[model samples]
Target: MDLGIAGLRVVVTAGASGIGLEIARAFAKEGARVVVCDVDAPALDALDSGLAGHVCDVSDRAAVDRFMHAALADLGGLDVLVNNAGIAGPTGRVDQIAPEDWDRTLAVDITGHFNVTRLAVPALKASANPSIIGLSSAAGRFGFPLRSPYAASKWAVVGFIKSLAMELGEFGIRANAILPGAVDGPRIRSVFEHKARERNQSVEEVQAQVLATTSLKRLIPPQHLATVAVFLASPLGASISGQAISVDGDTQMLV
Candidate 1:
């Protein structure tokens, strides 16, 4: 399927590596004119020549402002905004987690979405087929233990998208969130490692316990999320909005 997104203007946050990188690559593969922003300067420098990149920390409003200006200039305009930046946050019980950690998690995970979306909205409104895709998580839909900050931030993403869908519907802008499960990556591995040490268990045991919650008993591929994001932003998904679509492997819960 063509997905019919050739020449589409797109901006992806934190697109220098991991899931964000995969989504950026996917859009580029589909022939979209893409620009990505990340805090990692080296990763930005390493991005494919076909895709433009800038350094920006989404949690900082001023930084996001600068990034959006540069990205919009590169793309000439925008049709899609992929808010894929987030952090794992500190893993611990609610009372045990530091206040700073909690604040920082919400700052990057949820506030960052607002920082970018607010700037991208004007450009998106001008497009013929504008769409906003937010990267939530399975934790957004479930009560995750020892991961309260991350869970709370993701849940906010769903609420944010849902409200955007309603508010932007008249402008023909579609807003939706993609909830991913334990994705296969170094980030997840680090998360597992942290959890294991926190619980005094082996990494393998923690990993197995997490996978056991999913009917498929597997971690999600970043490419799978990229594909769904592309489809959602394409003309094929014109009628889809205000939905939190899960790309998890039939995940029953977050362990």
Candidate 2:
């Protein structure tokens, strides 16, 4: 099916690696001009030659605004914004987490979404069809041990998109959230190792325990999440707004 994203200008945050990189590649495949910004300059340069990239730290407001302007200027205008940059901060009990860790995680995960959306709102509104897709997680839908900060930040992302849907709807702008389950990626592996060490268990043991809770009994790939993202940005998804859809392989039932 033609997603109708051809020639459209799309911006994806944290597009250096993992799901972000896959999403950028998928957008390029759909014939949309993709602008990917990440702090990892080397990684960004390594992406497919067609991708337009910039060195950006989403947590920094000034840098984010500059990147947004550059993306808009380069793309000539913006039609879609993917607020995908986020961090799963130091994993630990709520009381064990440092103040700085909490602040830093929240800054990048939640506030960064706000920063990019705020700068791109006018451009999105000006487009004939505009959309915003936020990358939340299964943790956003449910509580878990040793992931307090991550859960909090992801939950806030959901709130941000829902509120934006209400405010942007009248202007023909759509906002939605994609919540993925335990995706198999470097970041998640790192988190698993951290959890194993923290909990005095083997890495395999912890991983097995986590997978057992999911209905799919396996990890999700970045491409799996990217496909949904592409759809949300496409003209076919114009009627989808304020919805929190999952790519979790049916991990948990939602109301």
Candidate 3:
């Protein structure tokens, strides 16, 4: 399926690695001109030549400003913005989590979306088929035990994306959120490790418990999310807005 996004201008946050990297690569595969920003300089340097990369921490407004300027210049304009940057946050009881950790999570997960979108909107407004895709999580829809900070920030992401859909609809810029559950990656492994340590259990036990909540009992691939994002940004998904689409194989809970 040609998503009909060839030559589309796009920017993806934290696109140097993990899910974000897959998104950038997917867009590039569909022939979209892609620019990605990440805080890790080494990762940025290692990105595929097809995808331009820059160093920027989305939590820092100044850094986002610089990245957006550079990225838009490279793309000549913007048609899509993929807000995929986020952190696992601290895994522990609400009382056990530190105030700083909570603040940081919100800053990057929610505020970071605001930071990038505000800058990308003007460019997006000029496009004929503009769209915004935010990477929310299953935790956003369900309460996650021992992951209060992550859950709170992800939930905020849904609200943010829904509000953006309403606010930007007049400009033909659609906005939606993708809620993935337990994506297969080092990040999820680390999250499992943290949860296991917190619950005095092994990583395998925690991983199994998490998968058990899903009907398919499996971890989601980053490419699956990339496919949904590309479709949403294409003309084929013009009517899809204000939606919290789940790519998680029928996940029932966050475990």
Each prediction's TM-score versus the true structure:
0.98, 0.96, 0.98
- Ordered list by TM-score, greatest first: 1, 3, 2
lDDT ranking from best candidate downward: 1, 3, 2
Q: Write the per-residue lDDT of candidate 3 for residues 81-115, one digit (tens) a residue.
A: 99999998887789999999999999999999999
In order, the Cα lDDT scores of the candidates are: 0.95, 0.90, 0.94
The best candidate by TM-score is: 1
Q: Which digits, one per residue and each the tens of the lDDT, describe model 2 over residues 120-168?
A: 9999888987999999988788886777888899999999999999999
Q: Flag regions of model 1 displaced more than 4 Å.
A: none
On TM-score, the stronger of 1 and 3 is: 1
Model 3: lowest-lDDT 10 consecutive positions: 190-199
Worst 10 residues of 2 by lDDT: 246-255
lDDT of 3: 0.94
Candidate 1 lDDT score relative to the true structure:
0.95
Over 4 Å off, model 2: 253-255
